[model samples]
Target: MITSSPPFFVPMNVGHAVVTGGSIEIVGRLAGQWFLRANFTSQLARDAATSLDVIYVPRRQANLELSYEWAPGSAMTGIVTYVGDRFADAANTSLVPGYLLVGLNATWALGEGYSFQAGINNVFDVTYQESLGFPEPGRTVFMAVTKTF
Candidate 1:
Protein backbone atom coordinates (compact mmCIF):
# COMPACT_ATOMS: atom_id res chain seq x y z
CA MET A 1 0.00 0.00 0.00
CA ILE A 2 1.18 3.55 -0.82
CA THR A 3 0.10 6.68 0.97
CA SER A 4 1.18 10.31 1.12
CA SER A 5 0.63 13.42 3.19
CA PRO A 6 -1.91 15.98 2.10
CA PRO A 7 -0.71 18.20 -0.67
CA PHE A 8 -1.92 21.30 1.13
CA PHE A 9 -2.69 22.30 4.69
CA VAL A 10 -6.17 21.43 5.93
CA PRO A 11 -8.15 23.19 8.58
CA MET A 12 -8.00 21.58 12.04
CA ASN A 13 -5.54 19.01 10.78
CA VAL A 14 -2.19 18.35 12.40
CA GLY A 15 0.69 16.77 10.56
CA HIS A 16 4.23 17.31 9.42
CA ALA A 17 4.68 18.99 6.04
CA VAL A 18 8.09 19.66 4.59
CA VAL A 19 8.82 22.25 1.97
CA THR A 20 12.00 23.98 0.82
CA GLY A 21 11.96 27.31 -0.93
CA GLY A 22 13.86 30.51 -1.57
CA SER A 23 13.06 33.93 -2.88
CA ILE A 24 14.86 36.96 -4.31
CA GLU A 25 13.74 40.55 -4.10
CA ILE A 26 15.23 43.70 -5.58
CA VAL A 27 14.35 47.39 -5.53
CA GLY A 28 16.36 50.14 -7.10
CA ARG A 29 16.26 53.36 -9.00
CA LEU A 30 16.54 53.06 -12.77
CA ALA A 31 17.30 56.54 -14.06
CA GLY A 32 16.23 59.95 -12.82
CA GLN A 33 12.75 59.52 -11.41
CA TRP A 34 12.41 55.98 -12.77
CA PHE A 35 12.49 53.07 -10.32
CA LEU A 36 12.20 49.31 -10.53
CA ARG A 37 11.34 46.43 -8.22
CA ALA A 38 11.39 42.68 -8.75
CA ASN A 39 10.87 39.45 -6.85
CA PHE A 40 11.24 35.76 -7.61
CA THR A 41 10.52 32.59 -5.68
CA SER A 42 11.21 28.89 -6.13
CA GLN A 43 9.94 26.10 -3.97
CA LEU A 44 9.39 22.37 -3.78
CA ALA A 45 6.69 20.90 -1.62
CA ARG A 46 6.30 17.18 -1.47
CA ASP A 47 4.01 14.66 0.16
CA ALA A 48 5.93 12.54 2.61
CA ALA A 49 3.87 9.44 1.88
CA THR A 50 4.56 9.16 -1.83
CA SER A 51 7.06 11.94 -2.30
CA LEU A 52 4.76 13.52 -4.82
CA ASP A 53 4.60 17.19 -5.59
CA VAL A 54 2.09 19.14 -3.52
CA ILE A 55 -1.10 20.38 -5.08
CA TYR A 56 -1.78 24.03 -5.87
CA VAL A 57 1.85 25.06 -5.23
CA PRO A 58 3.75 26.41 -8.19
CA ARG A 59 7.44 25.69 -8.38
CA ARG A 60 8.43 29.18 -9.39
CA GLN A 61 6.93 32.66 -9.36
CA ALA A 62 8.15 36.14 -10.27
CA ASN A 63 7.00 39.75 -10.21
CA LEU A 64 8.47 42.93 -11.63
CA GLU A 65 7.44 46.56 -11.54
CA LEU A 66 8.75 49.74 -13.11
CA SER A 67 7.63 53.24 -12.34
CA TYR A 68 8.41 56.80 -13.29
CA GLU A 69 7.66 59.97 -11.41
CA TRP A 70 7.34 62.90 -13.78
CA ALA A 71 6.64 66.45 -12.70
CA PRO A 72 5.45 67.05 -9.16
CA GLY A 73 2.20 65.17 -8.80
CA SER A 74 2.13 62.53 -11.54
CA ALA A 75 3.48 59.04 -12.02
CA MET A 76 3.12 55.92 -14.19
CA THR A 77 3.80 52.30 -13.33
CA GLY A 78 4.08 49.04 -15.24
CA ILE A 79 4.03 45.56 -13.77
CA VAL A 80 4.64 41.99 -14.83
CA THR A 81 4.13 38.63 -13.09
CA TYR A 82 4.94 35.04 -13.86
CA VAL A 83 4.02 31.68 -12.39
CA GLY A 84 5.63 28.36 -13.25
CA ASP A 85 3.89 25.07 -14.00
CA ARG A 86 3.06 22.72 -11.19
CA PHE A 87 0.79 19.87 -10.18
CA ALA A 88 -2.88 20.39 -9.38
CA ASP A 89 -3.23 17.15 -7.43
CA ALA A 90 -1.16 15.12 -5.02
CA ALA A 91 -0.81 12.41 -7.59
CA ASN A 92 1.02 14.87 -9.84
CA THR A 93 -1.10 13.66 -12.73
CA SER A 94 -2.67 17.05 -13.31
CA LEU A 95 -0.29 19.71 -14.57
CA VAL A 96 -0.88 23.44 -14.75
CA PRO A 97 1.12 25.47 -17.21
CA GLY A 98 3.11 28.60 -16.44
CA TYR A 99 1.79 32.04 -17.31
CA LEU A 100 2.78 35.69 -17.59
CA LEU A 101 0.68 38.79 -17.00
CA VAL A 102 1.23 42.51 -17.46
CA GLY A 103 -0.39 45.68 -16.25
CA LEU A 104 -0.07 49.47 -16.39
CA ASN A 105 -1.33 52.32 -14.23
CA ALA A 106 -1.13 56.08 -13.81
CA THR A 107 -1.74 58.38 -10.91
CA TRP A 108 -2.14 62.12 -10.56
CA ALA A 109 -2.75 64.46 -7.67
CA LEU A 110 -5.55 66.77 -8.74
CA GLY A 111 -5.41 69.27 -5.93
CA GLU A 112 -4.92 69.72 -2.20
CA GLY A 113 -7.32 66.96 -1.22
CA TYR A 114 -8.13 65.03 -4.36
CA SER A 115 -6.38 62.40 -6.46
CA PHE A 116 -7.12 60.30 -9.53
CA GLN A 117 -5.87 56.85 -10.54
CA ALA A 118 -6.45 54.50 -13.47
CA GLY A 119 -5.06 51.18 -14.54
CA ILE A 120 -5.32 48.25 -16.95
CA ASN A 121 -4.72 44.64 -16.01
CA ASN A 122 -3.83 41.61 -18.07
CA VAL A 123 -3.03 43.85 -20.97
CA PHE A 124 -2.70 40.93 -23.41
CA ASP A 125 -5.92 39.20 -22.37
CA VAL A 126 -4.08 35.91 -22.02
CA THR A 127 -6.26 33.06 -20.80
CA TYR A 128 -5.04 31.34 -17.63
CA GLN A 129 -6.13 29.80 -14.37
CA GLU A 130 -4.73 30.17 -10.87
CA SER A 131 -6.66 27.14 -9.70
CA LEU A 132 -8.28 24.12 -11.23
CA GLY A 133 -11.59 24.65 -13.03
CA PHE A 134 -11.49 28.39 -12.28
CA PRO A 135 -10.64 30.92 -14.99
CA GLU A 136 -9.03 34.23 -14.14
CA PRO A 137 -10.47 37.45 -15.50
CA GLY A 138 -9.34 38.61 -18.89
CA ARG A 139 -8.03 42.08 -19.71
CA THR A 140 -9.64 44.61 -17.43
CA VAL A 141 -9.52 48.36 -16.85
CA PHE A 142 -10.37 50.32 -13.73
CA MET A 143 -10.30 53.88 -12.40
CA ALA A 144 -10.65 55.49 -9.02
CA VAL A 145 -10.83 58.92 -7.42
CA THR A 146 -10.00 59.72 -3.83
CA LYS A 147 -10.68 62.76 -1.69
CA THR A 148 -9.55 63.66 1.79
CA PHE A 149 -11.36 65.88 4.17
Candidate 2:
Protein backbone atom coordinates (compact mmCIF):
# COMPACT_ATOMS: atom_id res chain seq x y z
CA MET A 1 0.00 0.00 0.00
CA ILE A 2 1.18 3.58 -0.70
CA THR A 3 0.39 6.70 1.31
CA SER A 4 0.56 10.34 0.28
CA SER A 5 0.82 13.52 2.35
CA PRO A 6 -0.51 17.02 1.63
CA PRO A 7 1.92 19.59 0.34
CA PHE A 8 3.32 22.05 2.83
CA PHE A 9 4.12 25.71 2.21
CA VAL A 10 6.97 27.84 3.56
CA PRO A 11 7.63 31.58 3.19
CA MET A 12 11.16 32.84 2.57
CA ASN A 13 12.73 36.14 1.65
CA VAL A 14 13.89 36.68 -1.87
CA GLY A 15 17.66 37.08 -2.28
CA HIS A 16 17.60 39.29 -5.32
CA ALA A 17 15.29 40.72 -7.95
CA VAL A 18 15.65 42.13 -11.46
CA VAL A 19 13.73 45.25 -12.41
CA THR A 20 13.84 46.98 -15.78
CA GLY A 21 11.82 49.90 -17.01
CA GLY A 22 11.77 53.24 -18.73
CA SER A 23 9.77 56.43 -18.60
CA ILE A 24 9.02 59.11 -21.18
CA GLU A 25 7.77 62.62 -20.49
CA ILE A 26 6.70 65.58 -22.58
CA VAL A 27 6.02 69.18 -21.60
CA GLY A 28 5.17 71.97 -23.98
CA ARG A 29 2.96 74.97 -24.46
CA LEU A 30 -0.05 74.56 -26.75
CA ALA A 31 -1.89 77.35 -28.55
CA GLY A 32 -0.21 80.17 -26.61
CA GLN A 33 -2.51 80.01 -23.63
CA TRP A 34 -2.66 76.28 -23.11
CA PHE A 35 0.01 74.03 -21.65
CA LEU A 36 0.32 70.26 -21.74
CA ARG A 37 2.41 67.82 -19.76
CA ALA A 38 2.35 64.05 -20.05
CA ASN A 39 4.40 61.07 -19.03
CA PHE A 40 4.27 57.30 -19.23
CA THR A 41 6.17 54.54 -17.50
CA SER A 42 6.46 50.78 -18.06
CA GLN A 43 8.39 48.25 -16.06
CA LEU A 44 8.91 44.58 -15.40
CA ALA A 45 9.90 43.33 -11.96
CA ARG A 46 10.61 39.68 -11.45
CA ASP A 47 11.92 37.50 -8.68
CA ALA A 48 15.22 35.83 -9.52
CA ALA A 49 14.27 32.48 -8.05
CA THR A 50 10.74 31.98 -9.29
CA SER A 51 10.70 34.38 -12.24
CA LEU A 52 7.39 35.74 -11.02
CA ASP A 53 6.38 39.34 -10.91
CA VAL A 54 7.09 41.26 -7.74
CA ILE A 55 4.20 42.07 -5.49
CA TYR A 56 2.82 45.62 -5.42
CA VAL A 57 4.70 46.62 -8.55
CA PRO A 58 2.62 47.85 -11.43
CA ARG A 59 3.58 47.11 -15.00
CA ARG A 60 2.49 50.45 -16.41
CA GLN A 61 1.54 53.93 -15.28
CA ALA A 62 0.79 57.28 -16.84
CA ASN A 63 -0.21 60.86 -16.14
CA LEU A 64 -1.45 63.81 -18.16
CA GLU A 65 -2.17 67.43 -17.36
CA LEU A 66 -3.66 70.22 -19.43
CA SER A 67 -3.78 73.79 -18.23
CA TYR A 68 -5.24 76.97 -19.61
CA GLU A 69 -4.34 80.47 -18.61
CA TRP A 70 -7.36 82.65 -19.24
CA ALA A 71 -5.90 85.74 -17.66
CA PRO A 72 -2.58 87.07 -16.41
CA GLY A 73 -3.22 85.84 -12.86
CA SER A 74 -5.64 82.99 -13.26
CA ALA A 75 -5.28 79.44 -14.56
CA MET A 76 -7.27 76.24 -14.68
CA THR A 77 -5.93 72.72 -15.01
CA GLY A 78 -7.20 69.20 -15.53
CA ILE A 79 -5.32 66.06 -14.62
CA VAL A 80 -5.60 62.37 -15.35
CA THR A 81 -3.68 59.49 -13.82
CA TYR A 82 -3.59 55.76 -14.46
CA VAL A 83 -2.17 52.83 -12.53
CA GLY A 84 -1.78 49.34 -13.90
CA ASP A 85 -2.69 46.04 -12.36
CA ARG A 86 -0.31 44.33 -9.94
CA PHE A 87 0.00 41.32 -7.76
CA ALA A 88 -0.85 41.60 -4.08
CA ASP A 89 0.81 38.46 -2.88
CA ALA A 90 4.16 36.78 -3.26
CA ALA A 91 2.82 33.80 -5.18
CA ASN A 92 1.08 36.16 -7.67
CA THR A 93 -2.28 34.58 -6.94
CA SER A 94 -4.02 37.80 -5.95
CA LEU A 95 -4.25 40.72 -8.35
CA VAL A 96 -5.31 44.31 -7.83
CA PRO A 97 -6.99 45.72 -10.86
CA GLY A 98 -5.91 48.92 -12.57
CA TYR A 99 -7.53 52.28 -11.83
CA LEU A 100 -7.91 55.75 -13.32
CA LEU A 101 -8.46 59.05 -11.56
CA VAL A 102 -9.40 62.51 -12.77
CA GLY A 103 -8.98 65.90 -11.14
CA LEU A 104 -9.55 69.63 -11.78
CA ASN A 105 -7.94 72.63 -10.18
CA ALA A 106 -7.70 76.41 -10.44
CA THR A 107 -5.38 79.05 -9.13
CA TRP A 108 -5.75 82.82 -8.92
CA ALA A 109 -3.27 85.47 -7.86
CA LEU A 110 -5.01 87.65 -5.31
CA GLY A 111 -2.41 90.42 -5.52
CA GLU A 112 -0.30 91.71 -2.62
CA GLY A 113 1.70 88.48 -2.72
CA TYR A 114 -1.27 86.24 -2.07
CA SER A 115 -2.91 83.44 -3.97
CA PHE A 116 -6.02 81.34 -3.78
CA GLN A 117 -6.21 77.73 -4.98
CA ALA A 118 -8.80 75.01 -5.05
CA GLY A 119 -9.10 71.54 -6.49
CA ILE A 120 -11.22 68.41 -6.62
CA ASN A 121 -9.59 65.01 -6.72
CA ASN A 122 -11.05 61.68 -7.76
CA VAL A 123 -13.80 63.44 -9.71
CA PHE A 124 -15.71 60.23 -10.36
CA ASP A 125 -15.35 58.75 -6.90
CA VAL A 126 -14.30 55.43 -8.36
CA THR A 127 -13.73 52.66 -5.87
CA TYR A 128 -10.39 50.91 -6.09
CA GLN A 129 -7.74 49.21 -4.02
CA GLU A 130 -3.98 49.35 -4.28
CA SER A 131 -3.39 46.67 -1.69
CA LEU A 132 -5.36 43.80 -0.29
CA GLY A 133 -8.14 44.91 2.08
CA PHE A 134 -7.02 48.53 1.88
CA PRO A 135 -9.23 51.08 0.12
CA GLU A 136 -7.99 54.39 -1.24
CA PRO A 137 -9.66 57.75 -0.83
CA GLY A 138 -12.28 59.05 -3.26
CA ARG A 139 -13.82 62.35 -4.41
CA THR A 140 -11.81 64.76 -2.30
CA VAL A 141 -12.11 68.53 -2.43
CA PHE A 142 -9.55 71.04 -1.17
CA MET A 143 -9.00 74.76 -1.03
CA ALA A 144 -6.22 76.97 0.22
CA VAL A 145 -5.09 80.57 0.39
CA THR A 146 -1.47 81.57 0.79
CA LYS A 147 0.51 84.75 1.23
CA THR A 148 4.18 85.22 0.46
CA PHE A 149 6.62 87.59 2.09
Candidate 3:
Protein backbone atom coordinates (compact mmCIF):
# COMPACT_ATOMS: atom_id res chain seq x y z
CA MET A 1 0.00 0.00 0.00
CA ILE A 2 1.37 3.42 -1.07
CA THR A 3 -0.17 6.78 -0.40
CA SER A 4 1.15 10.26 -1.09
CA SER A 5 -0.29 13.29 0.64
CA PRO A 6 1.93 16.30 0.12
CA PRO A 7 4.86 17.33 -2.07
CA PHE A 8 6.77 18.83 0.79
CA PHE A 9 7.57 16.89 3.93
CA VAL A 10 8.87 18.16 7.25
CA PRO A 11 11.23 16.26 9.47
CA MET A 12 10.32 15.55 13.07
CA ASN A 13 12.13 14.09 16.04
CA VAL A 14 10.55 10.76 16.87
CA GLY A 15 13.09 9.90 19.61
CA HIS A 16 14.70 7.21 17.51
CA ALA A 17 18.25 8.36 18.01
CA VAL A 18 20.51 7.03 20.76
CA VAL A 19 23.96 8.10 21.86
CA THR A 20 26.17 6.28 24.34
CA GLY A 21 29.41 7.41 25.87
CA GLY A 22 31.55 7.36 28.99
CA SER A 23 34.13 9.72 30.40
CA ILE A 24 36.97 9.43 32.88
CA GLU A 25 38.47 12.26 34.87
CA ILE A 26 41.40 12.29 37.20
CA VAL A 27 42.69 15.10 39.36
CA GLY A 28 45.63 14.98 41.66
CA ARG A 29 48.56 16.90 43.03
CA LEU A 30 51.92 16.56 41.36
CA ALA A 31 54.64 16.87 44.01
CA GLY A 32 53.69 19.92 46.10
CA GLN A 33 53.41 22.87 43.80
CA TRP A 34 51.71 21.43 40.73
CA PHE A 35 48.16 20.18 40.16
CA LEU A 36 47.38 17.79 37.33
CA ARG A 37 44.07 16.82 35.78
CA ALA A 38 42.98 14.80 32.78
CA ASN A 39 39.78 13.79 31.03
CA PHE A 40 38.80 11.32 28.31
CA THR A 41 35.61 10.42 26.49
CA SER A 42 34.59 7.56 24.23
CA GLN A 43 31.32 8.10 22.40
CA LEU A 44 29.15 7.01 19.56
CA ALA A 45 26.33 9.21 18.34
CA ARG A 46 24.49 8.00 15.31
CA ASP A 47 21.32 8.32 13.28
CA ALA A 48 19.15 5.23 13.26
CA ALA A 49 17.56 5.87 9.88
CA THR A 50 20.65 6.08 7.73
CA SER A 51 22.99 4.27 10.15
CA LEU A 52 25.55 7.00 9.56
CA ASP A 53 27.93 8.72 11.91
CA VAL A 54 27.20 12.27 13.05
CA ILE A 55 29.08 15.27 11.75
CA TYR A 56 31.95 16.71 13.79
CA VAL A 57 31.48 14.07 16.46
CA PRO A 58 34.74 12.36 17.23
CA ARG A 59 34.76 8.93 18.83
CA ARG A 60 37.61 9.87 21.12
CA GLN A 61 38.61 13.12 22.76
CA ALA A 62 40.76 14.05 25.71
CA ASN A 63 42.43 16.92 27.55
CA LEU A 64 44.96 17.51 30.28
CA GLU A 65 45.68 20.46 32.54
CA LEU A 66 48.65 21.15 34.75
CA SER A 67 48.95 24.10 37.09
CA TYR A 68 51.89 25.22 39.15
CA GLU A 69 51.74 27.62 42.09
CA TRP A 70 55.05 29.39 42.12
CA ALA A 71 53.96 31.73 44.89
CA PRO A 72 50.89 32.78 46.78
CA GLY A 73 48.11 34.16 44.61
CA SER A 74 50.11 33.42 41.50
CA ALA A 75 49.80 30.38 39.28
CA MET A 76 50.76 29.12 35.85
CA THR A 77 48.66 26.60 33.98
CA GLY A 78 49.32 24.49 30.90
CA ILE A 79 46.72 22.62 28.90
CA VAL A 80 46.84 19.89 26.26
CA THR A 81 43.93 18.64 24.20
CA TYR A 82 43.37 15.91 21.65
CA VAL A 83 40.51 15.34 19.24
CA GLY A 84 40.27 12.16 17.19
CA ASP A 85 39.40 11.91 13.54
CA ARG A 86 35.81 12.37 12.46
CA PHE A 87 33.62 12.82 9.46
CA ALA A 88 32.48 16.15 8.08
CA ASP A 89 29.12 14.93 6.86
CA ALA A 90 26.55 12.42 7.99
CA ALA A 91 27.50 9.88 5.36
CA ASN A 92 31.17 10.01 6.41
CA THR A 93 32.38 10.99 2.98
CA SER A 94 34.84 13.67 4.09
CA LEU A 95 37.38 12.78 6.74
CA VAL A 96 39.03 15.11 9.19
CA PRO A 97 42.29 14.13 10.85
CA GLY A 98 42.99 14.13 14.56
CA TYR A 99 44.50 17.20 16.17
CA LEU A 100 46.44 18.16 19.28
CA LEU A 101 46.56 21.60 20.85
CA VAL A 102 48.69 23.06 23.60
CA GLY A 103 48.16 26.22 25.63
CA LEU A 104 49.63 28.06 28.59
CA ASN A 105 48.20 30.65 30.95
CA ALA A 106 49.51 32.60 33.90
CA THR A 107 47.53 34.46 36.53
CA TRP A 108 48.64 36.78 39.28
CA ALA A 109 46.15 37.88 41.86
CA LEU A 110 46.80 41.28 43.35
CA GLY A 111 45.16 42.76 46.38
CA GLU A 112 41.57 44.11 46.33
CA GLY A 113 40.17 42.07 43.45
CA TYR A 114 42.87 43.01 40.98
CA SER A 115 44.47 40.41 38.73
CA PHE A 116 46.72 40.04 35.71
CA GLN A 117 46.43 37.25 33.19
CA ALA A 118 48.06 36.20 29.95
CA GLY A 119 48.09 33.12 27.75
CA ILE A 120 49.05 31.57 24.45
CA ASN A 121 47.23 28.88 22.48
CA ASN A 122 48.38 26.54 19.72
CA VAL A 123 51.92 27.07 20.90
CA PHE A 124 53.42 25.22 17.95
CA ASP A 125 51.30 27.04 15.39
CA VAL A 126 49.61 23.80 14.43
CA THR A 127 47.50 23.85 11.30
CA TYR A 128 44.20 22.05 11.67
CA GLN A 129 40.46 22.30 11.27
CA GLU A 130 37.88 22.06 14.02
CA SER A 131 35.03 21.68 11.57
CA LEU A 132 34.31 20.90 7.94
CA GLY A 133 34.89 24.05 5.95
CA PHE A 134 36.14 26.28 8.73
CA PRO A 135 39.87 26.52 9.42
CA GLU A 136 41.00 26.59 13.01
CA PRO A 137 42.96 29.50 14.31
CA GLY A 138 46.73 29.26 14.56
CA ARG A 139 49.12 30.29 17.33
CA THR A 140 47.33 33.02 19.26
CA VAL A 141 48.27 35.10 22.28
CA PHE A 142 46.06 37.03 24.66
CA MET A 143 46.33 39.01 27.87
CA ALA A 144 43.95 40.67 30.30
CA VAL A 145 43.96 42.78 33.44
CA THR A 146 40.98 42.74 35.78
CA LYS A 147 39.82 45.02 38.58
CA THR A 148 36.67 44.42 40.55
CA PHE A 149 34.85 46.63 42.94
lDDT of candidate 1 over 1-149, digit per residue (tens): 12224454242221444689999999998899998999999998776656777676788999999999886668899999999997766568877788999999998989997889999999999899987567899999999999978
lDDT tens per residue, model 3, 3-100:
11122222334234457899999999989999999999999877666666665678999999999998877899999999999876555677888899
Better of 1 and 2 by TM-score: 2
Ten-residue region with minimum lDDT total, candidate 2: 1-10
Model 3: residues with Cα > 4 Å off, grouped in runs: 1-15
lDDT tens per residue, model 2, 1-149: 11112232334455678889999999999898999999999999888877888777899999999999988768999999999998776778878899999999999999998989999999999998976568999899999998989
Candidates in order have lDDT scores of: 0.82, 0.85, 0.81
TM-score, per-candidate, Cα-based: 0.84, 0.84, 0.84
Q: Find the number of clashing residue pairs for candidate 1.
A: 1
**C-alpha lDDT (0 to 100) for residue 149 of candidate 2:** 94
Cα displacement (angstroms), candidate 2, residue 37, comes to 0.6
Q: Tell me the lDDT of candidate 2.
A: 0.85
Best by lDDT: 2
Model 1 C-alpha RMSD to native:
4.3
Candidate 2 displacement at residue 16 in angstroms:
1.7
Backbone collision tally, model 2: 0
